[model samples]
Structures are given as C-alpha cells and as structure tokens.
Target: MVKVLLLITSAVLIILSLLQSGKSEGFTGAFSGSKGLDLFSNSKERGAEKVISNLTLVTGVLYFALVIIAILGQ
Candidate 1:
C-alpha cells in the first residue's frame, strides 16, 4: 500500500511541477533590467495557477512524509 501511494504521489508531483509557470524568465529579466518585465510583480495568483501552486505544496509535503514513513516502516 505504501509503495502504491508513493508511486501515485510521484506521478502527481511530476504533473503538478509541469503545470506551473516558469520562473527562469524572471532571473533573466532581473539581470537585464528589462523595462516591461515585472520581475518582482506583486500580482497575486488568481485562478488555476493559485490552485495548482497550493496543491503542489501540499503534495510535496505529503510526498516527503510518505517517504519517511515508508523508510521507517521497513
């Protein structure tokens, strides 16, 4: 059961990570100091991005906990 859960958590983590928006542009923008770039934009996550971000965090914590549990269970 633990193995099955670990597999599912990993798959979900991959999918969620893929769904998130890239932050690399911000790094480049910071170095370039682009006029239109909002490198430190104050805009809040307002929709799917917000949900996905929260879900990713929760799943990440859960994944970590599960890994510990599996290791200790053995």
Candidate 2:
C-alpha cells in the first residue's frame, strides 16, 4: 500500500512540475528586481499558474511525507 502511494505521489509530482511555466527571467532577473521586463510585469501568478503552483507545493510536501513514512516502515 505504501509503495502504491509512493508511485502515485511521484507521478503526480512529475506531471504538476511539468505543467508549471518556466521562469524566462533567468539569473539576470534574480540580481535585479523584475521591474523593466514586460514579461515579468505580472508580479503574481494568476489563473491556472497559481493553481498549478499551489498544487505543486502541496504535492511536493505530500511526496516528502510519503517518502519518510515508507523509509520508516521498512
């Protein structure tokens, strides 16, 4: 049962991770606040981006918890 859960969590994580949009700003934007770029104009992720981002974070935490449980079970 734990193995099955681990597999499902991993698959979901992979899918959610892929669905997220790539940050085009790169390292340059990290050094300086993304103020000039129109591409980075949107300070917040709206719509599907926001949903996917939240889902990814939730699934990532679930995955970590599952891994710990599985390891401790063994």
Candidate 3:
C-alpha cells in the first residue's frame, strides 16, 4: 500500500534525477555563461529541462514525506 507507493515514488525520483543534466560543464557539455546553450539548442529544450528539474524536486519532496509517513505509521 503506502510502502509500495513510497518505493515506486523513490524509484521515479531516482530515474528523473539521473535523466536530468548536471549543472557542471562536463555534464552539460558547455561551460558557465554560455547563455544556456549546448545540447539544449533552443528555448524549447531549456523549458523541458526546467520542467524535468521541477518534477524531480517535487518527487523528491514526495519521497521524503512518504518516508516520514511510513515511519510514523509504524
């Protein structure tokens, strides 16, 4: 039930985090002050990156909340 959901949420968070590009130059393939250009190419790619970052943050929060709930339930 709750535990299963929590596990799934955690897995999703992990995957999302992995899928996201890192802030460092090595990961993004461009150094700082490049104006957010690299593999992203254009505004659409940047927007998609933002969306994924937001979703990763949200899912991370959810995962933490679920862990607390599971602990408190015990």
Candidate 4:
C-alpha cells in the first residue's frame, strides 16, 4: 500500500524531472541556432511545467518521509 505509493511517486518525479529543459549553459543554443527559446523556442510546455515541477518536489518530500517512517518502524 504505502510502498506502492512511494514507488509511483518516485517514478512520477523521475519522469517529470526529465521533462524539464536544461539551461544549455550558453553554448548549445549559441551555436545550434536555438536562441529565443523557452527550451527550444517557438513552443512552450503550456504551463504544466510548473505544476509538474511542484508535484515532483512534493513527491520527493513524501518519498523521503515514507522511507524514514518505514525505517523507523522496522
């Protein structure tokens, strides 16, 4: 039960975190003609990025809490 929820949350966090774009470090975009982009320019994540990011953070916190509880309970 709780373990299932923990695994699901972990998977969701991993997926959501992967959906985010990296900062590019000012090199990839500079030479790849990918400027003026919110991750690649021309298109955005439709605001779901924030939601997913927040949820990922929350899930991460919950995962840690669950781990602590399980460890302490044993």
- Per-residue lDDT of 1-74 in model 4, one digit per residue for the tens? 77787788788878878877664546666677765335545444447776776777887898899888777877
Weakest lDDT window of 10 consecutive positions for candidate 2 = 34-43
Q: Per-residue lDDT for 1-74 in model 2, tens only? A: 99999999999999999998876566687668763355635558899999999999999999999999999999
- Itemize residue pairs with steric clashes in candidate 3: none
For candidate 3, which ten residues in a row score worst on lDDT?
A: 36-45
Task: Name the runs in model 3 displaced over 4 angstroms.
Answer: 26-45
Instruction: Give each model's whole-structure lDDT.
Output: 0.88, 0.87, 0.80, 0.73
Clashing pairs in 4: 37-41
Count clashing pairs, candidate 4.
1
Estimate, for each residue in 1-74, the C-alpha lDDT of model 3 and write its tens digit.
88999989989998998998755456354555654445545433468798898999899899999999999999
Clashes of each: 0, 0, 0, 1
Candidate 3 — what's its lDDT? 0.80
**In lDDT terms, how accurate is model 2?**
0.87
User: Cα deviation in Å at residue 63, candidate 4?
Assistant: 1.0
Q: How close is every model to the real structure, measured as TM-score?
A: 0.74, 0.74, 0.70, 0.59
Candidate 1 segments exceeding 4 Å error: 26-43
